[model samples]
Target: MVALRVGLALGTMAGAAQAEGVLPYRDADAVARGERLYEATCATCHGRDLQGEPDWQSRDAEGYLPAPPHDQTGHTWHHPDAVLLDIVRRGTAAVVGQGYQSRMPGYAGALTEAEMREVLAYIKSTWPDRVIAIHDRINVEAGG
Candidate 1:
């Protein structure tokens, strides 16, 4: 009985481990739709390739930064899933505290949660394997 229980526990854990982290939010069609939305709504400022304008790390005289890249070069992947989701839904000020102004717009009313998830999934799918692994670990540690 003990051995059977242990084996079952291990099997459950293994199954969970194999489950795709992106699966819940991953919808290729939705991602494709998000890609269009990203291009139309985000690409101009963020860049067609998701690379922000020059000196993305530096702030302009107005205190606004050029949008940063979404790929591995930037710190986007360093943030956990919830943080990213919130940023998309509520804008930077929601998480960055009061008086923080960002060129990034809040999508609270503009997008449904599924649409937000699709956008994020699309972004995640573009990341390098290493970045994805790090994000996966972050998600795991975050108890997601």
Candidate 2:
């Protein structure tokens, strides 16, 4: 049973790695650029402190999802780095499927891949050490 669990975990890790490839950047400058871009593009709805808005988990009358918080308080970190990047580049609608609407904009034409990595880095940088460590474990398991 223990071995089975280990095998499953390793398999999951390998699959995730295969899917995500590698993170594009690891430097401070790229993270800084991402932070700037996030500030300009994402902060209004997500909040400067990453707290998100009140009732962020609840949808509005129009059926739009409330902008979720980027902090640990929300589920943002539950996603893998690759998934997050896709969401940023393609918009939440792309991931959630058509007929689903999201206020998030696709940064595909607006931001470079490196820029997307930077933004992601900036968001990760804000996380506490524990969360960061978890992310690192995820990266390691994913073959980063």
Best by lDDT: 2
lDDT per residue, candidate 2, 45-117, as tens digits?
9998888888987889988888899888987776778778889899999988968988988899989887888
For model 2, give the RMSD to the true fold. Answer: 6.5
Off by over 4 Å in 1: 1-27
Tens-digit per-residue lDDT, 70-120, candidate 1: 878888888777788888888987679868878788898998887777777
Evaluate all candidate structures by whole-model CA lDDT and list the values in order.
0.77, 0.79
TM-score of decoy 2: 0.77
Residue pairs whose backbone atoms clash in candidate 2 = 34-118, 34-119
Give me the displacement of residue 21 in model 1, in angstroms. 4.8
Best by TM-score: 1
